[model samples]
Target: MAKTQEFKATERIEAPQGGPGRGAMGGGMVGQKAMEFVPSGKRLAARLRPDRGKAVLVVLLGVVSVALMSVGPRILGHATDIVFNGFIGKQIPPGTPESEWPQAVQGMDVVPGQGVDFDAVAHVLMIVLAIYVGASVLGWLQGFILNTVVQNTVRTLRQDVEDKINRLPLGYFDRSPRGELLSRVTNDIDNVSTTLQQTMSQLLTSVMTVFAVLAMMFWISPLLALVALVTVPMSLLVTAQIMKRSQGQFVAQWRRTGALNAHVEESFSGHALVKVFGRQEEVEAKFAEENDELAKVSFGAQFVSGLIMPSMMFIGNLNYVLVAVIGALRVANGQLSLGEVQAFIQYSRQFTQPLTQIASMVNLLQSGVASAERVFELLDADEEPVDATGAAAPGRRGEVAFEHVSFRYDEDRPLITDLSLVARPGQTVAIVGPTGSGKTTLVNLVMRFYDIDAGRITLDGVDITAMPRAALRSQVGMVLQDTWLFAGTIRDNIAYGRPGATEDEILAAARATFVDRFVHSLPDGYDSLIDEEGSNLSAGERQLITIARAFLTDPALLILDEATSSVDTRTELLLQHAMAALRTDRTSFVIAHRLSTIRDADLILVMEEGAIVEQGTHEELLAASGAYARLYQSQFTAAAVGEEV
Candidate 1:
């Protein structure tokens, strides 16, 4: 059997301490301040290297389109001059007064009776129409190509993040909230995707239009161009100030969004618990607080970024007034033509528009980069170390031994120290311990979820450290207390571990685990659909499916970590029976809180504060009357009292 590559499913902790976008939305994260990180534009750009050729093509199309757009007003101005000269100037006498003559002929070339050239003017208009149409076509092409590139890039980015999540060490997940990691993949990557889709082509077009308009304005008249240039610095100054104030807010917005997602996820997942405890009002209040914070940050970001448009318009209008006054004076002085002044005014308006658009996109770009930074941070996380280069272990016979193992989740507070045990083939070793007594830690070490700090673990006399994780895990099967079922049919969920299992094998495993009883009664039989996390099914039902899943694999070694803790007495009895049959001929390690359930174990190890304090059969431990005996007596007495009541 090939081991599953996906990590074990577990809900993330609430309010994880740190990840990308830390201290992004407001002060700190999870009620504590976290260090902030803003990704560089150049860094985000580097991700596009693979699509450089297509990106360049899109930019080139944008430039051509803007060039065509720029020439339209100039050609139209020429046509206006032609029409004015052909008809209006025929009446201006050659000896007209110099001051009056300027007004009459300022926009006309006077060749007395160059009468209206209707054909020439119509021809120029037609060429201008053609240019506009061509530019529109180029614009559409650029947008289409860019969309393809952007979507493909985003798709690849999401895949990389998924692969990274699988490779990351379990310790990373232990410290971070699942919601926050989810935000990185879903929200953060989506932010980047939005920027690429909406802003990339627009940014390119705006930049090209600005430069193209400037060049056309200078060609029309340098004097008017100079007047228009005065507004450029003022516009830039306003944009820069607003951008500076809004940068942090944009970063904060995404952070708040992630926090809000985490809160909503946690509340919904624990909704039953909240209702049972009558904390609905409290949960709503918390949701409101997070929602309000997110709204405030988002509003600040948008409001500040929004100021660029009206501010640029004001600068544009002011520049227009100056150009009109000066161009008219120059026209009256016979130094500039009316047609040139009109074209220059159009160019100035065009210039201001692109500046405004670029200013507006600043928010999107910053938000995207912030989100990209978060995603990159996950991609750069420390992954689990590869297995040591040594000979692969022979197919495991489940002869497991831990040699002087010592470990801790945190270095300062050790959880397990110098623990040693041996489970012979076909031996069913049961572990019992009080809460936080390291019962689960023993199984975790054996599976190498977190490698031991010191000493070695072996399977069938072969060092496990040398075996690839996938290979080692393939030989072992785990059924945890929390049953995880993905969105699929019941049959598929059961056949997850052994994907190639036939219908016969699946039905046999289900029968052995007693899942067939329920499947046979359901409307869809084995084909019933399981919703996300299997919320549609009862707790016992989900556990039964997981048990059948483990059974289908027929693993050489089995680990059951409190697999029946959440069920009722009847379900527990049924599960225990199924477990007894499944454990036959296989080395098994079982951790349980109900001591009675494990009374038939070949061996029982009682743990306390990370060390084994007792080891023996149930009768043997009772005769010794030590910690195990006391624990059993207390449980037995409680059961007797409940029965009497």
Candidate 2:
């Protein structure tokens, strides 16, 4: 089995000084925030680690860089031991051991005859300068490579999220909050990028540097090293405590941001409607409320994160003072040489370096955890249908059957019930219903937009639920009541239905739907740019363009919903003829109003309150005096009155 990544998931915490998101760890994550999303930490590290050749080169250079850092201190300590301790400008006395250290070590001797090696210090200083140059060059290369890896990985993660969204069932889009989804894709993934590229790499280098310094410090004076060690665990504990506080706040902050984003998206998408209805003030008020909530959460998170730096500074300063004072006392007591004392103090700075970094990285960790939780949540959302996994049933000619189908938007709001219908090749089946009577819902099911709560729909005698969604959808075409023309040339929009279609085919499709008339009227004809949503085109023109798209596809199954309702009588007459021609060689489903459009339909299904109450040819249904009969009667009576007027 492929191993899952194991990133820490943060949720709203309960009961603590501060925990994950909600304030402390005890509050628990709100939903799936508790799930780990990253691959194993070790695995993540391994992938990020420098490859062998690069690792060896960088480490060797890092060694030289660290050694250069050690150089300044050794020179200063020697200068102090010789000048301040009155051992300068002369060779060591004959009794002085060659270990050079003034302190005694068990079974060890320090040649402490060094007075002042000014010439030698000068030589090593040159070497240190060279090492510094080498270190800088290598650091640049290492950083460049690591950043490249991190950026690529982050890019891959973003692509993965996008691809998953695409493969997810259409129902997933209907059910999810657009704001929350956007947050996961943009904000959350960006956090992972920042942390991995910056903090994670720095942490690795800091760990090595800290250990190297401690090893050198212990060699200089084991007792003083022990004193320095005293502060290590304490500093780490303080950092950990602060991190525990800050991480939770950040998690909560991210969640709040997502909620605020959702509010903004909804408000902005509805801005025109709000203005038209004079609800702008109400919308503004709602936006402000959400913004304030985000601010409150953000402040809490950022305040805790900001505090970590100061707390670490305090701990580090205290340790620095203690190390210096104790080192001085030990030197005065003859237990530590001036040189050794100086080296111990230098090492003390190194000890706190990583502790300082740990404090700083806490914020990054918190942000990363929050993002990881969201990413994991999306990746792990349950798929819509378990059986939509196979190839589509093969047939060149179209046939669709709804077998005792039922569906509900929610348990309390059923939009379809016990619906059964069929459409065969070369037949136009018209569905007539009042609003909320499941006209669109029936079409949605045929497209497999939603699976029936209890029934099967089949194409070519095979259950559509068993087919891969993409494969099944490839054979279907639709022209919706609300025609949307994208920003493209007339030819481009028509040809979009079959991207590889020849220009002649596109022009032919446009002519078939009467879109060529409008194209010829435009300055650039078929090459003219259509403004957003085809706003440049008249409603009739846009509808024709959409019908042109559907015609271009030559789909085995076609849907035209209120296609001619928005047009003038002349345009409707044109559309009626075009549709008739389009319907001659394919199976078609149409949702019709304007009564005259469905007069010649081979079959008409009249729906009421989610059930099919009547079905037959136009005259047959009129004869039955059912729901279809009443609808025809209403139209005929209205027409009769208009005639008398």
Give me the candidate number with maximum TM-score.
1
Query: Tens digit of lDDT per residue, candidate 1, span 312-425?
Result: 878888987998899889777767666677777788889888887888788888788767766777887778987778759646579899899898876688878898999988
What lDDT would candidate 1 get against the real structure? 0.81
Clash pairs, candidate 1, are 24-252, 25-252, 28-33
Models 1 onward score TM values of 0.90, 0.84
Error of 2 at 640 (Å): 9.3
- Candidate 2 lDDT, tens digit per residue, 149-244? 677677777887887876676555554456656877898889888878887557756776788788888888887778777877877777667666
User: Cα lDDT of all candidates, in order?
Assistant: 0.81, 0.72
After superposition, candidate 1 runs with Cα above 4 Å error: 1-38, 94-108, 388-394, 567-577
Residue 78, candidate 1: alpha-carbon lDDT = 85
